[model samples]
Target chain A: MNMKLETIETDVLVIGAGPAGSTAAKHAAMGGAEVLLVDKKSEIGTPKRCAEGVSKNGLEKLGIKPSHRWIAAEMDRVRLVSPSGIDVWLNQENVHLPETGYNLERKVFDKHMAMDAARAGSQIMVKTLAKELTLKDDYVLVKAESMGNHIEIKSKIVIGADGPESRVGRWAGLKSTSKPKNMESGVQFEMVGVELEDTRAVEFYFGSVAPGGYAWIFPKGDDIANVGLGIINSMTSKNAYHHLLDFVRECKATQKAVSVEFNVGGIPVGGPLNEFVTDNVMLVGDAAGQVNPLTGGGIISGMQAGLIAGEVAANAINEGNCSLENLKEYETRWVEENSLSFQKYLKAKEYLLSLSNEELDSIARAFQGSDFERIGPMELLGKLVKVSPKAMVKLGKIF
Target chain B: MIISEFCMYCGECAGVCPRNLIEVGENTLKFGQKPCKNCQICIQVCPVSALEVEG
Candidate 1:
């Protein structure tokens, strides 16, 4: 690692090099802004925090084509497991869903995305941690440390693409705190000896295994999978790791599985922040709480917001105005694009959190042997309402 | 706040801190100079229960 003291200036500065930051940097550079993107980690992505599942449609939306280099597995089926071990399966032919796509090798995928940003003329820096932000009238001064070397970056706009533990939002004085109930504590293990009922399917287990959230087995190969779970800490004293261990121990499919890697992180399940822009600073991705409240999935959404923020920042810089009023466009556009679905998901999440183990099993029972190919979402909900009216009361109104 | 050796520097604590008083490096977790209100939100969110109140 080269530790060099430096001072640089750019039209846009992006913090974090995850999916959101990389996409923001790529799009901003493509928009003709002189962009600089930085990540605190020595590598762009490692110790993977996600289940690495993404849809073909999500990549299509971002104009990204699937490459075998970063694709671990192609999935056509999604299995939802009940507390009592009943499984309800859905496939692409049965229902159009975003989750029926492919499992990604995020380590390779993230770096490739960053490489796209570099190809678009964005300067990239790894092992660079942004320490402080100084707000100025026209530009923000960023004090960063790169491998023990102090560096300064002055930019017309700063995009906060940092992950869940985002400091950028806080530094900019945004109301960025997620309530304990709204945050999901997640733990995952890359297990090599896992047995899968369907090698091409991704499985989700719901009930006591994970309170508020659910457990998942995202297969990376025929025999290896990223088995994980996320649970709301406020709902239980057991913590996420224990819940994951319990799930693994209890599941028949993972009896022979041994963990080769352990990963842990937090997911913000709150809807997007009320505001993600302040003067020249705009927040994207998890920093802006742009994750799906129900699924705890943010990669696609984050990248979408990143593209928007990149373009908006570039336009604001081109117009020589990086004011709060100018950056407000980003928030407005993002909300317009996501608010409806996000709100619905938030309500569904609340409903899901209220379910008991029995309620979960009953709901799964309702779907057992049902022809998924002919069942619409409304029919599914109707079944849910029949099986668990008490829990469905809240969910009914959301639909 | 005390971060135990069990900590993996995953930043779950920092994200849940209402005061934004924790910073996570690659292999480090440090409380900011600002006084922690002892909200204990960090402790609750820790996956391995790695964070605790200072004695």
Candidate 2:
């Protein structure tokens, strides 16, 4: 195999131009680092795999203005339906900033984020795939393919913000493999031309309908919605797409389905990877398993981690130290900020997954007549702890 | 080349393309034959079926 070696230099190199990668590039460039962001795809967010629901707090932290072209609708409430079809409605008062849900146009949102990184002076290379990572004397070498040519870029630090199936993390020598039981395969569909009254509310169906996972209905607008469902592979050997199709049929949403777009993906339900960094390399976003185990959301946590990783990388480079010890600061920042929430959510998911359909129905029924304030996370966790003291004890160890 | 049913109308392919060869419409995301430079990055990263080169 005859391959050409072309060497370029940068202060920081970020792999994958997704939410996390772009955010890292933006922050690194803002910190005055010569950052290069690369993605294998020609476009930034074309495939539309995410559910596109971000909490208001998450958006605020990123300082992003919710664009009219990007927002499908604002959600203020959530309904959790049990196995027996008993619905428990939680109003805005119960959830944190319920009135500020974002139904994002992921393609536009992701592209705009990359543009922000570019505006911050980060160079973005589209259609460039990072094939492998190699460590030389003191720099991390990024071997990539761009337009049938082999390109090599050297940087003092490399950040892996790739998705769940991240090769960059693995190439960087991090144990990034997710167990089958820890991963949930998900499928989502964008449905247009459907009339629904609760345009500002997102709905979730739990228990038997989703087994270890849940089904969601996030409204985009008056008649457009993103209907999706996730199921842990360990629960049943059924493909996520088939299960999602069955749920769609059961809900009778398929009857009026005019135009539907499908996305088949996976979520790492595990809390987080054991290690997020090594010498001169840090993994952020789904690549580091930074997703919320309960809601399967990663945009907020991913971006947050990206910011920390970027800062840590730049600092380490400036100090002439890129060892694992220096990179441990990124790990410390992430754990101090979001590890507790992730652990709590993971415990909640485990307990919820262990319940029988009848138990789930009972829990849903118990909350059916109750107000939203009565079903907060603390209250829900307290109830679960009461039921399963052993599980609660395990969660206590992490806290 | 024809756009597939998987297109989500994200308008991303057009934004990233150097040649401005792709256009997303109301119902469908389409690609024009404005000579795509045969850059297959769009095909590699397209989450849905918005763009593809003719066989």
Candidate 3:
């Protein structure tokens, strides 16, 4: 046995220091629990993986005000480019962007959230990689390597905010339900010299170019943007990176863009895991797959879920009952708060995935200048019926 | 073993490779100086059937 290892105890242990993990740590500590948060990265959000867009109102609903330090740009409008290159402009009251979305400087944003959690009295350790964990019914023991030292942490409950791989959740023996079809492969380039139509509008391109997924151009300034695309795993026999390069070469705006940084990663399109809580373990964030399928957004939902999980975790520790039944409250509450929108959007994703390039073009043209603020399934189907009844019929059945 | 054209750039293969022999690059995969022991977990975990072993 290694006796030089340090042992610490806390009421809650959060793995990963991403936005979700920090939020969970903050709330749990505020609820009077001794919380410890850890991440393998030296910095929480370096080498950015996301397109860094957040719904303004959605952040407000979570009580988060975008700090100017991390707000790259504020967007009040968006344009959806169809396969045929027809543009559909959507503003407030019409699309998911709803009121507005903010392009973020994630490095600053993640550090701010993590610092906030530390201020709330949550102990944080960076460069700590969780290697193994054991559940002992009443408590859990997490084995990790910090810097060059071995450490053991004992906690009443563990919140798995680790991203898609979710080593902590898997170590706790929680089963996830993500399917191959429920995930996407994404590649992005933060490029300079990309022109923006509107300084406040992000653009989305939908067509065969992305193959069951979509491409995005979110501007950070008048001349710089994060240009990216996600492709369904089953879409083609070619590398997703190649498709993104093709996009950079083909798009008028990004054609001459000079790449500043590159990011490649997996995106979960699944709504949520069925059983996220095990004895003494509560899963949060990407570990629970809380990303919205249709929008391919995870940060807002993950933070919200983390908030709920932290409160529930502290309660379980206080109640001295970390049973699965007690932890089920987190699951029930998150589902209640998110199920309606998430499920509806997931169904919409399925409907959208079934469409072909031609059908997608027709749908985009039908919604051109749809003066409406927002559209529901029935309204969209009604419009599509005029353009392509065949698509309408298939979509109606799916919806 | 060889990688096919279906590499999606998800980079999961590089994470699971025991020998740390793979590096995901801007447009192509980079191999380390060491020879691969053919751990094949990269093949098993690939979602798109991009990796294959020659008979």
TM-score of 2: 0.82
Return the lDDT, model 2, position A241: 63
Output the worst ten-in-a-row residue range by lDDT, candidate 1 chain A.
A390-399
Q: Which ten contiguous residues of candidate 3 chain A have the minimum total lDDT?
A: A91-100
Q: Provide chain B's TM-score, model 3.
A: 0.80
Top TM-score: which candidate number? 1
Clash pairs of candidate 3?
A: A93-A373, A93-A374, A94-A373
Write the residue-wise lDDT of candidate 2 on A86-161 in tens digits.
8877666566642247878889989998999999999998878676688776789887877668899999889987
lDDT of 3 at A378: 76
Best by lDDT: 1
Candidate 2 off by > 4 Å: A1-4, A97-100, A195-197, A252-254, A374-399, B1-55
DockQ-derived CAPRI band for the predicted complex in model 3: incorrect
Candidate 3 chain B lowest-lDDT run of ten: B19-28
Per-residue C-alpha lDDT of model 1 across residues A1-399, encoded as one tens digit per residue: 776657899999999999999999999899899999999999889767888888899899899988999999999988989999999988877776565588999999999999999999999988888888889888999998888889999999999987888898889888887788778898999998899999999899998889889999999987999999999987887989999889999998889999999999899988899999999999999889999888888898899999999999889888999999988988898899889989888888788878889888888888877788787778878877887776467877765
Model 2 interface root-mean-square deviation: 12.1
B40: Cα error in model 2, Å: 29
lDDT of 3 by residue, B1-55 (tens): 6777756545556544555456453234555677888756666546455788878
